[model samples]
Target chain A: MIPTPDLSHLKASDYETVYEPAEDTFILLDALESDSDTLKQLRPRLCLEIGSGSGCVSTFLGSILGSSEALFLCTDINPHACSCSVATGLQNKIPLNLVNASLADPLLWRLQNAVDIIIFNPPYVPTVADEAWTAQADRGIGGAWAGGKDGMEITNVFLPHVSALLAPGGHFYLVAVTQNNIVAMQQRMKDIYGLESQVVLRRRAGGEHLSVIRFSKTLAVKTAVFHSNTSNNEVL
Target chain B: MVRLITHNLLACHAKGCTSNNFPLQFKDVQIVVRESEFNPDFLRGFIPKIEWPALVSSSRELGDTSLSDQLPEMLDDAFLKTLHRVLFEIHVEEGVMICPNCSHHYPISNGIPNMASSVTLLIRGLPYLASSWLNMKLANDLKIS
Candidate 1:
């Protein structure tokens, strides 16, 4: 197994400002590690991590795929998290491009339908909707977990962007909780966006059931659907 | 520092300023060059996704003339190495990314770009919170808040 990226450089003070790698973060890492072979095979050129708090996830991805030529782009609202992410990338010898932007807003048109891999471990804790709005505005540590209103408020804002941002055959990995209505989300992606998804990894972590849902647009599924339609026509 | 890879994906996000916003023009850039281990295979995979004109012009703006205006068709090791350096090695430590259209400035200091805008998006998103509250109100009427 590929060892986790070196985050020893981040101190407690850093955590006070930035998000410390937690169970949710590890689960994301585990899911990525579990898919190492597939990721290597994909040979992704551009990898983006929205809300890259400690940079652990992107660094781990760099380590898995080998930070040779693929660009590792990270965005965080928290300036401290941005700094910590850059520091972590430097520590791990992964040259991460840190953008202190909210939800890849600055990159929308420039990266339209072009990103090969996207991951977001958004704020997913249920809180008052006002709290989530305030936390997001604050752009601080609170922004990491104050997910307001079934914890889908922040993640929901980003959902539409997923289908718009991904390239053909590109994959998006999102870390969500039961409160976010995982099944409903999967259905919505399939129904509205034509994006196929599955629960890549899930585990009960304390009160929160964390799951990493990997969504993608692949030609194989389309081919299967086409074949099924052709067979129905033949039968008719 | 902003690398060409990042530059290639960044556009000015000033409100109501969309077209010609891409390839943000660099001004007063402080660049730092650092060597990263080269993997030819990754470069080969990456070339297709990049906006070649943007990458070339942006790299030249950062004072690296390693590449030509046009990307080469042949995938030679020498060409790939130069492409790799232009894309990954040169970094913009301190600068202002001026929007070509709106002329808004995004500052980069200490290797991190501040993409925060004049008007914060979350503030505009307050209506979303109000909508969420309305949903909660309905849920509460059904005794499900």
Candidate 2:
């Protein structure tokens, strides 16, 4: 197993503002690890991660895909998270390009249909809408977990853009809790954007039923016809 | 720190500010070149995906003239090395990325670029407040400037 990126440089004080990696982060890492073979086969040139709190996931990804093989671009709403991400990349010997932007705002247009891999571990804890709003505005550690109204307020805004941002045959990974209605989300993506999803990994962490769902654009008729059974049977 | 590879993917995201916003102009950029292991295969694969003109112009703005205005018809080791240096080796330690259309300034300090706007700060929570407040602030800031 690939070891987690060394985060020895960060301190407790840093966690006060930046999110400290937790179970959600680890689950995402595990999901990526399980899919490393497919990811390496894709030969991705660009990988974008949204809300890269501690930069652990992207750094881990760098190890999986050789450090120099793909350009790792990360975006974080919190400025402190952005700084910590840069430091973590440095510590792990991966050149992570960080943008202090909210939810890939500055990158959407330029990266149209170009990004090969997209990962978002958004704030998925159910909370009052107002609290989520405040957390997002605060742009601090709170923004890492306060998911307003079923924990999908933030994730909802980004869903429509996934199909636009992902290149054909690209993969997108999303982390969600049971409260987020995993099955419904997968259906919506397939219906609206023609992207098929499979729950790659799931675990009951504390009170949360965490899931890592991988989505990819549905291929043309010939390929889709052949893979239909395999994809349908992949529901786990 | 921000690098050209990252910068190449960035466009201005200010609300209602869209056209001619790409290839953010660099101002007072403090760049450092750190040598990295060269991988020819990766560079070769990435060449077709690059916006050649943007890469060339942005590199020139950062004071590297190794790449010509035109993408070379042939891909050779020497050219790949130059491409590798301009794309990965050079780092923008400090700079201000200005939007050509809106003139929005995205500052890079200690190697990280702050691309968040006032609208983005509040849009997630208070969309109504963000729009009204953003308009007022933009008007006030524009007047002041």
Q: Which stretches of candidate 2 lie over 4 Å from their true place?
A: A219-236, B127-145
Q: Give one digit per residue, the lDDT tens place, for model 2 in A48-96.
A: 9999999999999999999999889999989999999989998999978
What candidate 1 gets wrong by more than 4 Å, as runs, is A220-236, B131-145
Residues A183-208 of candidate 1: C-alpha lDDT, one tens digit per residue: 99999989877899999999999888
Residues forming the 10-long window of minimal summed lDDT in candidate 1 chain B: B116-125
All candidates' lDDT scores? 0.83, 0.85
Error of 1 at B144 (Å): 24
CAPRI level of candidate 2:
acceptable
* lDDT string, candidate 1, B7-91, tens digits: 8888777666657887999999998998878889888877776899988888888878888888888989999889878877888
Model 1 docking tier (incorrect/acceptable/medium/high): acceptable
Best by DockQ: 1
